[model samples]
Target: MLTDPSPTRIDEATIRALPKAEVHVHLEGTFALADILFLAKENGEYLPGPAATLFDITTHDAFAAPAVSTGGGAGAGAAGLSGFLRFLDWQCGLVRTPAQAARVAYAFAARQSASGVRYSDVIVNPTHWNAWRGREIALMRALSAGFDEAEQDGLCAVGIAYSLLRSQSAASAVDAVATLASARPGHVVAISVDGDEKVTGRTGEKFHEAFRLARATGFRRTVHAGESSGPDGVWDALDLLFAERIDHGVRAVEDPALLARLAADGISLGVCPRSNLTLGIYRSWDEHPLPRLLAAGVEVTLNTDDPAPLGSCLEADWAVTAEQFGFDEATMIGFAARSIEASFADDDRKAALRSELAAVVDERSRTGALSS
Candidate 1:
């Protein structure tokens, strides 16, 4: 039933219409330029560049730094992590209050709808908010309100994953995780790790300790690894952090044994093609390691790591992967199922999403509307 996307196969529109979940998005990464400009103006902050300059990564390793926890006010650098941070630097000015944070959350959901994203769990870092409010709970409260508002607008459930950067001291990360733990149940889904891959690089001790504490607290975990680094980074994340998933595990493709281990363990890879391409993991979309990973039976799902900065949407990401890599409908559908299975959403929610995905695929087949 899976029709692979090929030059002579399915057209672009079909891929766009397919139901899917975006699993690897970052709240700070996807901040739109318009939103950045407005937030900066409202908060009297100086922005780093014009709206058009936000996505400028001249080379792949340019986005390798961990995020710094500057107070809610703008910092010496733009957003403060990658180009996405520059955009954040602009918006941090306005997000001084809960209302501004809610606005950003609602806007994210609304934009995601246009991209045909049925569901998404965004990672929000509370350290910055805490630095400003002297209370870490404000970030959780603002994002909870945002998700509530998005749900009212008919958007599918939007979950939050609290994250902290590798640059934070071990004590800081522990506090961030503690704040995240207290805010659970009625709000955020789980806690995660993001920031410099080197922090978890084969030899980084601080990150190893931070992640251990997070997992010990019963928080679900995922970490950024093997993006700017290599397979050992991926292994470290699995062994040390107890990651249920790896954000950008494409580098695993280079090690056949490791790939087999990933498939055997049933771990998930949150693959983001545009992010990889922009970050220089692949020369182009068609050259991506996704196809290789798929062939090896690794559980892989498509996502737009940072939609705005990278100029990709969820649908666009799916479309490009299918068309460029020759993914048939069956493969695409399988990826969707894998995404639902790998989601932090509980069993009932996963069942509902998987069933809906199956029905959509079946109905498309029954109607004979699929392009071949």
Candidate 2:
């Protein structure tokens, strides 16, 4: 049964112990500063930030503190987006070979384990990886190889979401869909659209044919919207791309009608509180509309959008959201359940994960590990 509307206290340990899936994490943003530093030296690449402060963002204490003002305050919405994206490019450039790419994917699974993420639908936009300009299929295979190895070793399983940047041409989007469909990449489960929605304005109509082809080719659909853009982008995702899941749909709270449609359709929003705050979507957690979205019956799930770069982890995101927003234990459990359900993983895997989730959460309650 669900708890009262008034939020109850739930411990971070309990939230971490609960089984979950990450549906919105970007593969290009998964590198740790240590990894980046090591790779930079090995590959002789340029790193934008000073080595001294680059690693600071990975610390938990630093994450929960005031935002790192690299020309953007907490409220300076998208002020330093170019710098942030430049960092992603630099990180993606470090993968000089397929082995290195595999290492990135392998490390991602290991890192996610710390946050109790059992599986993930990770987005990989080729726009960031300039090194793989004409060899995206090879890069995808390398990542898939790494994820397969991790899954074989009982690490967090991953599904690749081949994303179309809103910055790209509609013809390119169609070509990408066709190429992916022809290749039939076994591990690439979904097709998605990402990048600065604000900068791209609205391109859903342009990519509608691509998304339609993606559906015909058996690719699940998800889209990045309602974070950098208004609720209209989300509406485009739903109405044009027919996205089944939305990444960072917090801005949908601005539209009552959209919120109602989302709830009625049972579409889940992969909300990353830390990313929103860091990106200045909302000034603070209290200012975020997560609670209001919940009240409106939206299926909300917590995720770390760019965990390593943003000093984020699923455990911390879940914990902070619960404590800051006064969510009860039951609500937190619902988060895990919803995340797994929203993932692009296979049905058998989802069912197994659901069972594991139930068993773990139930055991925690029984053993007093999770106090209600």
Top lDDT prediction, candidate number:
2
- Which residue ranges in model 2 land beyond 4 Å of their true spot? 1-9, 55-79
lDDT of 2 at 180: 93
Superposed model 1: Cα runs more than 4 Å off: 1-5, 8-12, 46-87, 127-133, 198-200, 203-205
- Which candidate leads in TM-score? 2
Candidate 2 has its poorest 10 consecutive residues by lDDT at 70-79
List TM-scores for all candidates, in order: 0.85, 0.91
- Residue 9 shift from truth in candidate 1, angstroms: 5.6
Counted clashes in each candidate structure? 12, 0
lDDT tens digits, residue span 64-182, model 2: 23323321111122335554665566668888798888888999998887778899999999878888998888889989999989989989998999999888888999999999999
- Tens digits of per-residue lDDT for model 1 on 230-328? 798788778877788888888898899889989999999988877776555556766677778888989988877767766667776776667777767
Give lDDT: candidate 2, residue 230.
85
Worst 10 residues of 1 by lDDT: 69-78
